[model samples]
Target: MNYFQPKPISNFNATIDIPGSKSITNRALILSALSGKTITLKNILLSDDTQYMIKALRSLGNKIEYNESSKILKIIGNKNPKYDNIDLYIGNAGTAMRFLSSYLATGTGTATLHGNSRMNERPIKDLADSLTQLGVKVEYLNKFGYPPIRITSSGVWATSVKIDGSKSSQYISSILMAAPNFKNPIDISFIGKVVSKPYIHMTLTMMKDFGASFTLKENSINIVPKEYNLSEYLIEGDMSSASYFLAMSLISNSTITLNNFFKNSIQGDSKFLDVLLKMGLTILDFKEYSITVKGTSSYKGIQLSMNDIPDVAQTLAAVALFATTPTKVWDVENMRIKETDRISALKNEISKINGDFIEFKDGFLINPKPLEMYQGDFLETYDDHRMAMSLSLIGLKVPNIKVLDPSCVSKTFPNFFEEFNKIYRED
Candidate 1:
């Protein structure tokens, strides 16, 4: 029952390093397990989500060693992952649950993949349906679209798959990762316009890094079933988290430097620099690995569609509230299905602050105005780690905010409050 009380911040400082990205780390771990080669990954985020994936991988007879001192991961590949016929618990990691869904679909034995109470609620039928079409026997223990089910990987699969990409890219990524391992090459077509296209690109790029090949057509990806050979991989720093520090710099005139982050990262969230640039922030990149963002006086609000970088939507929305004018964001419908219904949650809190915000089915528009500060009330996290942390960025301006269920941050950034307090001020 730990709660985090917000401390107002006056001037934020320069230089802070967030851990390696959860996205890249999880992707690397899965690729390493599927790669059929010994691989070493440096600067990996050892959070709860990755830990769950590591446990699941080890349970499947793959050898995985994580070094805490150097933050290095050494992996011994498994050609045939020995499923011990145990229930794999993924907690609340959507990536772990989704990637594992596809990874185990290629296994020889029957394996069960499910998560916490929230995991069962998250929709996984999109992936399960795709796997079913590919000849994988996927059955739901409870509901058709939910988890807590049995997946038995048995026979040769389809030559191609028609996937509805409009819902989630994780569903597509899951199918794509396992498609190459199937007996047949997979061609994926979209049921509607694809959402979060960058994540699909990230999946493709990582697959290519492991010697996988593909041909992406107008609305399809054609890939021949092949092996993924692991090589040395160093994950990029989490710019999704870095966006908070970047936003802190913009709001508080702070100059912050982030390390091990590439300007040319395949991650779409790195494009947040362009968004901040539009907000009249000063950013200079000495090289791809290092950047300095300085707050400037030209901060003004503008409309943005952050569909590509949906993970940072909460932070951007908070930043918009502090902007020089009103802001509007679009293409966020997919965010509804995340760890929480983010749009509704933010609206509920903003209303309490006397803020002016308009919510839509897919997006929201907000006005820049001074709102009521947190009045020592208990703030709900909705079991979403980002919801707790992203709103912490707002805590710099709003005081007396107590975040209930503070430990929920362990799902992604475990030391969120510690890192936040390191940058806090007494007003």
Candidate 2:
């Protein structure tokens, strides 16, 4: 259970094929399930978060046949959805909880959407309140704005909603995904800043691809409900998942291949490549959907504002260690509400290495110029998968860097350490 130990290695170099994207995988799962058609999903991630979704879907009466040989997942649409009195446990995936909140609210039966301890702690009232405005009765089982929500779906509830977009895109995407049932499409207007705009775009694009109709302008999206013709949906590899390895080229100075990446991916995190590029990493396009990353012989610091793709903050923090100058990331407040308080966690742990970091109003600035190796110490992962995996990069170049709860990577990458060792082993 304690995977903590100092690992020291020199000259990290290897080509790695990262796992499927969690964001893309979850979207495909929900879309396939809703379309009531079998979707032959490719490169589905087999992490705990995804497995939790798969298991929950199976309980909801979806038959998923996974072919390990080719990494294809065949999700047999529910010929008869087993809503026969069951609670869908989403664990800690906010995406699962929010999207499903809007999704299951249209079901005929009463359903409960809930998760782990952290789930109840995380806010969902914004999403729940929006559902309620549309006649979807979402009652909080305990604390308001949190989970353990009770939803009793009647029919297609079409009511336009206006909400603050600065909160989270999952709220808006929730409305869009569940709007297909209304005789009148859901009309949503944003009241404040829209964070994670790319993800909202992704939802619209996916819905459009699946035959649903929608229009997005500025902060408003008009979704016209139509019967989506179910077909096989194959998702490209997750760029977020690939970011670690792509970043490895910079941190480890290795060549890594991230296969099946989409040039036009619905995943907002795909911008990670561009971010790394700004940091001086280059990609050699191998095939149409695959590329190899060759790091620049030298490193340069990049000061970026990560409001759009905030999830990569941890990786960027890790990447900062190799930069010639200090890297300052700003306006990433959303990182605080993720699996853990990421901003604080990043600062707390990074300080242990060299104690050379500063926290800004919304983000952190890492000064790796003073980074120095220390005695062997186990870095606690705080049950956050990103924190665990991101810390591993530091160990590649620094001695006595141990990672605790390395298994926490299963939240996204189940075989992270194994693959890490594989990509890092000396020839």
Best by TM-score: 1
lDDT of 2 at 204: 76
What is the Cα root-mean-square deviation between model 1 and the actual structure?
2.1
- Per residue, candidate 1 scores C-alpha lDDT tens digits across 1-427 of 6778776665566466677889889998888888768999999998999999999888887899889999999998775465756789988888999898778877788899888888888888877888888888888999778988788876447887778867788888887776667777778877777888888899899899888988978878898988888669988888787787788778766667777668788888888878988888787655778887788744798787887888888888778877878888899898888888889988877666656779999989888775453343556779888778776666667776667787887876777677676665322
- Mark the regions of model 1 whose C-alpha exceeds 4 Å error after superposition: 82-84, 371-377, 424-427
Per-residue lDDT tens digits of candidate 2, residues 1-427?
A: 4774535543445656667778778777877777777678877888778887888778877889998878889987552243655788988888888877666765666788889998788888777777777777888889887889988766655668876656688888777776775657778888767788888778877788778877767767777767666566666777777777777778766666666666777787888888889888877665667887777656887898899998888888888887888888987887888888888888788777764678875799887653354333577788888898788877766777889888888888887777677664644
Which lDDT values do the candidates have, in the order given? 0.80, 0.76
TM-score of each: 0.95, 0.93
Model 2 weakest 10-residue run by lDDT: 4-13
Candidate 2 lDDT (Cα, 0 to 1): 0.76
Model 1, C-alpha of 29: deviation from truth (Å): 1.1
Runs off by more than 4 Å, candidate 2: 4-13, 78-85, 370-376
